[model samples]
Target: MRVEQQPGFVLHARPYRETSLLVECLTRDHGRIGVVARGVRNERARLQRAQLEPFQRLELDLLLKGELATLRGAEPSGAVMRLTGDAGLAGLYLNELVVRLTGRQDPNPDLFAHYERTLRRMAGGEPLAWTLRRFERDMLDALGYALQLDIDANSGEPLDPSIRYVYDPESGASPGRPGDPHGLRGADLLALAEDRSPDVAGLSSLRRMMRQVIAFHLGGGELRAWRVLR
Candidate 1:
């Protein structure tokens, strides 16, 4: 399959053989893919080294068949982009999530859009916490694992903002479970569910809850980027 000038971002890259690179990319229409860019590392190569790094929007020319594709060329499709400090870690964390959860060639246009927007917001110095939460929610929705927020897992009624609750990853929110380590207030959960502004108090709780949810779905796979933040 030959593709030309397709828009994508390198999620990760590493040295392959002497002068080539193994690149993992997330594309607008092709989801996640792996590619071999031959001889790009040589001194006389025409491909821009700047465009091969992760988290930048790139237009890639590729020829793919089974597992890996041959990268014909790549160049930045937009302005230069960078993510540093906490934002960088958060971006990497999001990348890890996408790589782990998605199958090759499984297109999710919504996930791609959310990822681009989150990176833009983070690059612009917006707070990482809210941006991450929003992305996680959108990602879960797109992946068909969205958190159950509108109704209680047990009572089968609309959630009440006044009550305390515990979230079950496979299930949803239920009235507090005894000795439950992760507990959230009904109001905060509702705010997060509604995509409204969450106060500082609610932010921490929501983060923990989302982490638990993500971990459960991932079968406890560790995200090194998340550990760096903690």
Candidate 2:
């Protein structure tokens, strides 16, 4: 398969052989792809190396034969989002998630759009927690495991804001007993569902819940970005 001028972003890259690089890119129309960039690490290929950095929008040319595609050409399609500090680390985490969760060559335009927006928001100084939570919510939806935030899974009743709930990875929110350490406030979940900002405590609760859910989906594979960020 040959693709030309595909809009994409490099999720991760690592040195391969003597002067080549192995790249994973997420594209608007082609989900995720594994590519080999020959001679990208050569002394004279600084420009190619720079264009392959994460968070940069690229127009890629590819030739796919088998499992990995050969990166024929890459050029900047737009300005790169300048992410720094924890936001930079968070950006890596997002890339790792897409690489781990998404199937190669599978198309999910919605997730791609959410990822693009999330990165731009992070770079624009939006609250990291809120942006990440939104991405996680949308990511799960794209993966067909959307969280049930408004209703209690066990009782099949609408969640009461006053009540506390424990999120089940498989089923979603259920009423939690008083003093349960893992309990998340129903209000917090509701606020997240509606894309409303919650208090610091609620944000923390959502973070924990999302981590748990994402972990469950990973099926025991650890996210290295979590280690770096933490």
Compute each candidate's TM-score over C-alphas. 0.95, 0.96
Which run of 10 residues does model 2 get worst, by summed lDDT? Answer: 42-51
Q: Model 1 over residues 1-230: C-alpha lDDT tens digits?
A: 99999889988888999998888899988889998988888988888556688788988899988989999988788876689878888888888889888888887788889889889999998878888888898899999998887688997999989777898888899999655667778888888789885888688889999888988888987677777889
- Residue 60 in model 1: shift from native, Å? 1.1
Q: On residues 194-229, what C-alpha lDDT tens digit does candidate 2 reach at each position?
A: 989899999999988988999899995678988887
| Cα misplacement distance, residue 162 of candidate 2 (Å) | 0.7
How far is 177's C-alpha from truth in model 2 (Å)?
1.2
Residue-level error in angstroms, candidate 2, position 199 = 0.6
lDDT of 1: 0.86
